[model samples]
Target: MTYTIGFLGTGNIAADMARALNGSGHKILVSQRNAKTAAALAAAMPEVTIAPNETVVANADILFLCLLARTAAQVLPGLPFRADQTVISVMVDMPLARLRSLCAPATDIVLTIPLPPIAQGGCPLPVFPDCPALHRLFGDRNLILPQPSETALNAHLAASAICATLLDQMMTTADWLAAFTGDDDAAQAYVAAMIRGYLSDRPRPGALPAALRGLSTEGGLNATLRAAMAPAKDSLRNGLDGFRPRLGLPLGPEP
Candidate 1:
């Protein structure tokens, strides 16, 4: 079945989703709040339509709120919706209860988070998969995940810090290797391959720690670097510890 999906915001995240849905046999209705983005999307995908925000909400069967947390509060209160309309929220760090309160009386409200890689059909979308609409949208790429309590979700938000932190470290390592070898392209290629291999080949849950444990093989060169990096890893733990209290969760015992 072709679903008519309404996008309440046309930001980068929304655009990425639109690109994925383009020519996928889904009807897309885009909001006019971001006129340039909406027009661009409509131009790129002939099936997408540029409509006023209110009209888009009224016409489409499924509504996706892709706005920032602060903006969502202001926009949701003023928007039009029906009791039968299905709603999905993509805003990070916003609790499910808050979303339910804001969008109550809808047919169903789903809380979800997708990484930016959805455009390339590579995102491991974590969502409350109870809703059929979410199931259809995610297709086979989704990880069927239960919505953790708000506290757990907050912790996972901190977990996202690891991605940027690791990527930056990889980039620096690539640059350092380039300096030593005087071959920039080769250095980047090598680092890229290492990252892809590590991610693709690793086992789940204990994979990262297992890789680190392997580095400690009866005291080797990698073991020395692992010892040196202990302080940096501790700093990361401390940073996440500090964030817990800010979100009203107990700091607990620091790692």
Candidate 2:
């Protein structure tokens, strides 16, 4: 079924979503808060239109809340949401209960984290409360990971921050290669292609550990690098543990 998808905030993520959903046979209504982004999206996609926040809420079947937490708090309370609309929030650090309260009497609230890769499809979407509307919209192109709880969804969101760190590490490796080869573009392309090829294997459950074991062959360069990165791995774990309090999870070991 085609949907009237409304983006409550026209930010980068919202723009990306608009791009992803452009030809999905659904009409997209993007709020005019970020006029430039909304206008650009409308110009690029005939199915998309820029509209007032209230008009978006009044017309949409599924409303995506892509606003900042502060902006959502300030804006949502003023909009008129229908009881039939499904609300999906991508705002970081916003709790489900708070969203439910702000979006009431529209009880179909789902929390999700959609990364920038979504525009090109194949992005992993971590969604809370297994929303059928989201599945209908994104199941064909993206991986919809139905999270068990809000905390689990939040954990997935927190883990996504590692994408930046991974890219930084890749760029550092590319810089080192460039220093040795004196070819910056070639180094960067080689490093990016190598990483992409490695990740494209789509490891099955328990396959990651096997891949690591295979790579860490004793006395090999991969083994040497893996050994050297042990401290970095520990630091990554500690960083993830640091997010427990913010994610409303227990301070100690995960239950």
Return the top candidate by TM-score: 2
Relative to the true structure, how large is the alpha-carbon lDDT of every model?
0.76, 0.90
Give candidate 1 misplaced runs (Cα > 4 Å): 201-206, 245-250, 253-255
Give TM per candidate.
Answer: 0.87, 0.96
Instruction: List, residue by residue over 149-183, the lDDT tens digit for candidate 2.
Output: 88889889779989999999999999999999999
- Point out where model 2 deviates above 4 Å: 201-203
**How far in Å is the alpha carbon of 117 misplaced in model 2?**
0.3
Residue-wise lDDT of candidate 1 within 202-236, one digit each (tens)? 23898877776766776688787778788998898
Q: Which residue pairs in candidate 1 have backbone atoms (N, alpha carbon, C) closer than 3 angstroms, thus clashing?
A: none
List the pairs of residues colliding in candidate 2: none
